[model samples]
Structure formats: structure tokens, C-alpha cells
Target: MQIPVVLLFLGLLTVPGRSQNAATEQNSATDGANAGEVEEEDPFYKSPVNKLAAAVSNFGYDLYRQQSSRTATANVLLSPFSLATALSGLSLGAGERTEDVISRALFYDLLNKAEVHNTYKDLLTSVTGPEKSMKSASRIILEKRLRVKPGFHSQLEKSYKMRLRALSGNTQLDLQEINNWVRQQTKGRIMRFMKDMPTDVSILLAGAAYFKGTWKTKFDTKKTALQDFHLDEDRTVKVSMMSDPKAILRYGFDSELNCKIAQLPLTEGISAMFFLPTKVTQNMTLIEESLTSEFVHDVDKELKTVHAVLSLPKLKLNYEEALDSTIKETRLQSLFTSPDFTKISAKPIKLSHVQHKAILELSEDGERSTPNPGVNAARLTFPIEYHVDRPFLLVLRDDTTGTLLFIGKILDPRSV
Candidate 1:
């Protein structure tokens, strides 16, 4: 599947309440006179689901950073929420030492560990509800005929809504089943998730997600045309570009990163944020490093509403990767080696492979209503021109829960 290239940086603010309160108290004490005034806690930290979302989304950012660093010259797209879900579910089968490794990796150590799974259940429902356009699924595939403990199987399904499967030992049949399950989960939007089954599969983790989002304000089809998209300083490629003369969007320029950030609303409480560097050949390492749940939350709050002449590519992207190597490079290396999974089964087993596939589409389709007159009335003296005509970063997020649904680094629009 062909997918566009874009990079996204989200600031995830997920400090535990106890520590945050302690710091607040210390600051008040230091400031003496300000001690009488109590700062209101951020409502985001009050919800367990939001806390879990921040933790998993942070993992997603780290995963994206690792993958982008390795594939520096390639377009990278990942819907890592599913991967996080799979790993989080897998943790239920881990013993103490292995559990700690997984927990720290997911940043569960920063949350109420006892409520992680339950809160995750709530998060799954909120983000994957029918009203949302995203579909994500995860599964744990064990070695053929492995005896999975009934308790572990039940717990995984009950919390993560994931099922455990023991391979049938028929490579082709196993391949077909895995792909079929993915297709079913994504409502057939993603197909052929796997071409072949890996040999000696002790434990395989699979994750897949598909998103087809519609803009809150539609772009006129008549205005859409082929346009030049800069790949770098000298090279350019033709890509289908959607345009809007008076686009109302949230905008900000980050001096530190040397990038212009624009946010557009999509249906179902979702938003797509783009980070466009001033220069085509500009390195995106700084922007990637700045992504965290906290930072993204701050950006969301700091951006100003404005009018802009907007143009962006119409994209349909598909990305599939064997993430075993990428994951092994992280703290999760132990899982592929001597980690324990006694909770899952008595027989010794280790993680063999991890696979991920993501499909995302953004087009000109949206509600038929015209731009709000009130927004147009307050347009800047010289409306800002926000054109995504160069290599950029994109982040798709769920507004209600602050979940990082998708993050991509688009070096070239023409790359699939």
C-alpha cells in the first residue's frame, strides 16, 4: 500500500498527581505569599483513561522516533496505538521481572499500575467507538499447540479485547488466518496483512490499524489540482493537492524547531496537526525529539485560531513493517530472549516477531457547509498561507482523550 510521508511531534503531559502536587506545594512554599492560592489541577490528569492514553502514546512516539532514525531517508508511517495495545496485553502473561521491563517501556511506572489494564479497557472503548473512523486490532499468536493458561487468555480478552491463538503448524493456513483476522478487524480496509508466516514462531505479536478521516470542512473538488511538492532543495514531484482559499485553522510557529504548525479539525473529535519546516532539506530530528503527550497538550492550548490559504496533498498511504528489530532495540530486548511467561503457559516461550500495518487516507471529502462567516470576518490583515508543499510531519489525534492515533514523517508525497 502507498502512504504519504510526514513527521509529527506530540507533547504528552502525564505527570502523576502526587508528584505534580508535591512540586506545586514546594513552589508555593518557596513563594511564601502565593501559598494561599491553590492552582486548579488540569482535568486531563484526573481521568484514568487519559493517563493510560498518555503512557501508551508516549511509547508510540518513542517507537516512531526509533523507526524514523533507522529509516532516515524513507517515508515512515505508524499507527502505534495498536502495537502498544498488543504489548500491554502481552504484559499480563509476564512474570515479575519481565513485567517490569514491559511496564517501564510503556511508562506504566508513571501511572497507577493497578488500574492500567482496567483504564486501558475504557480507553479502547472511547477511542475505537463506532463514531470514530479508526479501527485498530491486536493479537497474540503462540507456538503451535502451546497450552495457554485459561486465566491469561480470559484476562487478555477481558481487558485488552485481544484473543490468543495457538498456531495450527500449517504455515499457509496460519498466514491466511492472521491476515483474515486483521482484515476483519479493520473492516476490510487493510488486506494481505502478512505474506508469509515466519519459521520457528514461538510467540508472535500482531497489530494493525486503518483510518479514513473526513475533514470537518470540505475542500471544493474543482479547486483540487496537481501541484509540485518539494522533496528537498532541488527535487520536486507532482502530487494531487487540495486547496481552500479561506481556511480557518489553528496555527502556531515554533521558533525553537523552526517550523510552522497548523491544525485542522476532522470529524468525530479528531484533529490532524502538521509541522512544516521552513526549509525543504531541514533535519526533523529536533521536532521528533520534542514529541511527548505533555508537549502536544501545550501546543494544543497555545495555538491561535486564524484564517489561512491552505493547500495540502490528497493522500492514501499504506505501510507494513516487521517491527521485531526496531522493538528489540528498545528495553524490550529481554522479551525476545530469556524473559519469563509462566502466567501464559508452563512451557518456556519467548517473543519471536512483532509485525505492524497501518493504512491512512485523507482526501477532500467533508461536510458540505461553507466556511463560517464569523471566522472569515476576523481574518488576519494578510492571511497566512499554509501550504504543505514540502516534506513535513503529521499527527492524527483524538481530541476527547488526547490519544495519539497516528504519526508519520512524509519526506515525499509520491512514496507509497
Candidate 2:
């Protein structure tokens, strides 16, 4: 089966509070004082879009950590770019004080804040371009009767390409509309987005995305069979595992993380990075905490290309969560109670809840043609063994723009 992925995100913001300045003024002043000194730019952050992508990707890592910590035993999957996009677009509608809260949460404090939205337009185009096979859409929803400021509306549309929605007060109709919009954005890949309408919504941010990937090397269908997947030291489950005796992949062993890292190429300039712990029932907290865009990039560069006797599970997973509590646990707690969105509307508003859902599938589907010429030319030696039989972490990244499309921790394939 083809590997299809879907992600949907919604953030609900409602009623009044005064805006308070974030505590970054002292630091900002210090940085400003030192700005006169000329310094070489870091290659990673040299471009505006790259800088913005790194900041948001870092936020994605933090979001994944928080969600993973909450559900320690269960699988955790998130397409945080969608959530980050929604929040970034909503920041345009925020007053200075409230905007700082969002800015800090998204790590925009580290970026040239003035060009963020504009750079995001470029980043969006690059990641969701036709060649990428990814479709993404975001929107802002308002209360039934709330009037949006013309300036905020225009800026949001111009930069974020998002439409504003005013609730009609009919719960079912509003719910239907939101779901339909999600379906339309994902080309019918995602059906129902929300089960019910949230009450007292003053403003809402919504985003959806869909992606399908084909592996560079296809696994033989005949080799796929039910195999034992170790869940823990004492537990195991049978899952359909795809095997390839001679798989060419980039490999690395992280002594610090005590995990094997493998990089597999996918079509459309995307790559899947997997981190398999050294043993079953090992604590993954260390590896989870170590995840960052820079670190992953370093690992990506340091990995070695080699032949591997590989075995991977055929996985189809779905996840849905209301991330209000998770967001509260982060640095963004104040948004739930006290936030100023006067720019969006004169009336006061604060964030209420965040909802997220994602679906991912991976199977033995790819080009039936011969492997890459490099793989064919390599002399056979002692091929390393890389089996994903235990719990593992996965990251799907867009190579061209360095955008994180998805992150997942698979504990039990059967559970999904």
C-alpha cells in the first residue's frame, strides 16, 4: 500500500484580558547594543526562510517532547508544523503583549521578527510546492458575531494565505464546515476533523496537511511476513514486517543516545530518520530530550552509507488529541487565561484549547526498477544488521527547506 499521511490541527481562543509585556526586554536591549559588531552568519541561518524554518522546527521538537512526556507508555505522533503555522498566523492578529507570548513560544525571539511572516510565505511555498507532494492549508475562525479588523484580515490573507471564518452559531453546521474544509484541503484523505463545536470560541486557528511518500528502494512483497516485535523485555507482539536482504541506507550509531540512527531516502526530496534504541524496554527520554534541528542535521551529515540487512514493520497509525493541557505545560500557559488579541478584534480574547490529529502509513511500496547505481557498484563486505524490532522514533523531514513534516514514537505497532 502507498504511504499516505495526514495531519489536522485546531486552536480555539476565547474572551478577554489585558496584555502584559513579556520579560525579554532586558535581553533584547542587550542584543541590540551588541548589534553594531559585524559577524559572519551561520550557514544554517544565513537565509530568512532557513532562519524561520529552524525556529519553527525547534518549536516542533518542544511540542513533541511535551506530548511524549504526557503519554509515556502510548505511541506519540505529531505534525507540529501545522500547529506552528496556525499559531504563527494567529500572531498577526495579536496585540504587542499577546504577540510576544506567541513569539516566544514559537522561538521567534531568536529570529528577525520583522521578516518572519514574509519569510514564512517563502517557506510555505517551498514545502508545499507541487513537487513536494504535500498539501497544507490554514484558517482563522471567529465568533459568530465578532467583526475582524480589516488590516489584520488583509495581512493574514496576504502573508499566510488563510481565510477568516465567522461562526454561524449553529453548532452542527459549523462543525460540518470545519470538517469539510479539512477534507477539501487534504483531498479527502482526512474525513471528520472535529467531533463537536467548542463553546465560547472568540477566535480559532485551524490547519491541515496531507503527504504520500515512496521509498527509494522497494521491499519485496513476498518477504513481508508476520514477525515478533519486542514491546518490552517480557512482552512481544506479532506484526507484518518487511524485509530486504540488501538495503542501501545511511547509517550511524550515536554512543551518547545509545541508539542506531538510519536514514532512508524517499521521493520528493524527503527522508525518514529512525532512531532505534539499543535495547527493548529502554528509557527513551534521553533521546527525546536530545532532539533538535541542529542535532539532527549534524547526525544527518555524519552518518555513513552502507549495506544493511534490514527489517521494518508495515505500520498504519492514527492519533488525535486535545492539546490544551499540553500547551499549558509549556511556556504558553498565559495564553489560556490572559491574552490580548485587540488587533484581531477590538473585543478581548484568549486561547481556550488546541486540537490535533495525524495519520501515517508505511508499507513495501516503491519503484520496482533496479536500485541506485551507487548501491549496485558498492563491493559486498560484512553488511551490518539493522532491525527495527523494538520501540523506535521516526522523523520525516523535507530536505530542500529543512522543514519537519512529522515526528512519531512507535511503542507497539499492534496498538495502533
Candidate 3:
């Protein structure tokens, strides 16, 4: 969901994820609780998020790939294809975040299988943690329901209860326990994430997952001291930053979106493809067009070493959103096909709600080093910025399917 959702059941239903019924109104007392706040920004806003979105968009495209030029009905199905588009467009953000895509995907794939779907009703609550990192990897969390078996009408929902069960109750195991789980997961590289949880409206059939984690290796404190970072047009600013010159995944520019792409390879070839704008928060058109899976592969092949520096501000942000509108904008409303879907309807499934939330924090680790306090008169072969002065994006993906696990853009880091 591009925003959050509140369910006003005709009568309150004590389902999972809620103790008392969530009211159907806004939290006025919490100012900007839904409005976003700015945070430390990267000169470019497309890195982590846009990369994730591109991967997801490509995956969505694969799902809708013409099942066959042979099917005469394929052309008419274009409308519902918007569902995939809508799913991809959301990477710009929904708030209270996680790079959670795998757990949700595994869960979704299970739901698509009747044996699993029928047996796992509370699967959302059944999932937990991912606290322990899988070798060479990252994650994305999402929870939303989807209609299936057209004539049969089926739906499913899954989230982090499994992670909760997996938790030893040690605060360290909690998803939100670490103040900068996100910063660490992304290598002190990503600084701002929206501070809103994915919406909580229940659905008969939905898919969802959340991800928050710390990087296995953090940047050296001495290297993290203030430095001037690059912005578009050769513009630069002095800000705090971090570095991992040894990181397997290095940063560089990609022709796609004329933005830079970061690759974090997971075990067995999987990787997170982070696409970020060079100088500004991207609009729908630029993002919707350029990105492709082959292009990602090409970029991976062409990766070259470069000085990577960033100065992102510490931020606290909050937001509430309803992605229904964003979905429509992305050309996805047709999946609701109460009508066309009726053609495939052996089962009756209707999507009652969809929502999301995300939260993120970025700051300097206690470690420090003596260096140029402000301007760096010394020129080095490579330069990385410390302060985040502009908007940015990130993503998680699977190398095998080239599936985009998660994607989002950080327009206002303070709000994340």
C-alpha cells in the first residue's frame, strides 16, 4: 500500500495483529503521524529503493508475461495486469518499512497452493524473525491478501507472527528493538526510512511480510567521520558518512533511469538491486519506463570501482497511506475483476482491503576519526559522501528469478 488502511468491520472482529479494534479514523494527536518528516538524504534518491522497485516490477511483468500468444484472451487481460504495476509502483514507499520480500513470497507461493492455503489460516502470525540472517542475504516484509481460483474465490494473508514465535523474547530478537536495524542491514549506506507500519486492515486472502535488520559488517568509525558528498551538477555538501571499501557489492551508475545501481549478492547468486536517482526524487514516468531485468544483468557485468560517499541526516518519520489510489495510477485495478474475474470464478474472492507502514532510523555509530572537519581539500582517487542531502530509493531481489523482493523511495527521510 502507498499508504495505510484501517478496517471498520460492521462489528469488531478480534483477528490476529490487533488487540482492540483499530479505529477507522486518523490519529490527530500524533502530528505528522501520517504526514512525513525529512531525514538525512543522499544526493541521489534512487539507490536502494528504485533498485528494489525495478526488480519487483520485472517480476510482476514476468507473472503477467503472455502465458501464451496462443491465448486469444491474453490481450483483454491487460487491465488486471495493473495489479503487477500497482505492486511495483509502491516501492516509492508505504511507510514503517522492511526489505521483507522472501518470507512473504514463500508464503504467497504456499497460498497459491491449496494444500498450504487451506492448512495455514493464521500464516501471517505464523511467520517470525528472519532475525537470524540467511547467508549472504537481506529481506523485505509485506502482508496483504489476494483473490485466487477465480471460480473458487479464495484469499490469504501472512505476516510476522512466525517471527514472534521464533523470537526468544530477548529484546535483541525483536524486529524493532535495534534503533538502526535498517542502517546496518544496508551498510550505513541507507540513512532514512519512513516511520509508519504497513496498514493493518484484514483480508480474506492477502500476502504480507516485514523486514528490518543490521548489516553483518558496519562501516569503520574512523572512515565514518564527516566528508563532502556528491550531488548532481557537481554540487557537494559536508556531512557524516560511512564506508566499506571491501564490500563485495560496490556502487556505480546505471543507464537505467540514468541512476546508480548497488548490488549486494546473497548466497546462490541472489542479490538486492538498489536503483537511486542521481539528484532528485523521481516521478512515475522515469521510474516506470527505463528499468529492466536484462539491464540489471548488464549493469552487474559492467560494475566498476568508484569513490562512494554520502551525508545523510538522522531522521524520524511517520505516514499513513491507502495504496488503492497508487495502484490505480500504476494501471492495476483490473485484478479486482469482480466481472472479468467472474469468468475465471469457480471460487468467489474479493479484495476488501490493502495497506502498509514502515519505520527507519539512520545515525552515526559512536566511533569517530580525526579528519577534515568540513571541506576536504585533499583529493583522493575515490570520494564517498557522509551527509544525505537529497531523496533516495532501495530494493531487494532474487538472482534466479530476477524477482524484485521489495522496493521503495525515500522522499522525506525525517518522515521515515
Distance from true position, residue 325, model 2, in Å?
1.3
Estimate candidate 3's RMSD in Å: 19.8
Candidate 1 lDDT, tens digit per residue, 99-202? Answer: 99999889887778999999999999999976667999888999999988899989998998788989999999989999999989888888889888999999
Per-residue error for 139 in candidate 2, Å, reads 2.7
lDDT of candidates 1 onward, in order = 0.84, 0.78, 0.33
> Where does the lowest 10-residue lDDT sum fall in candidate 2?
11-20
- Candidate 2 per-residue lDDT, tens place, 268-311, comes to 78899999988996899888887777566656655667777899
Q: Which regions of candidate 1 fall more than 4 Å away from where they truly are?
A: 1-41, 372-378
Q: lDDT: which is higher, 1 or 2?
A: 1
Task: Give the Cα error of residue 94 in candidate 3, in Å.
Answer: 28
lDDT of 1 at 141: 92
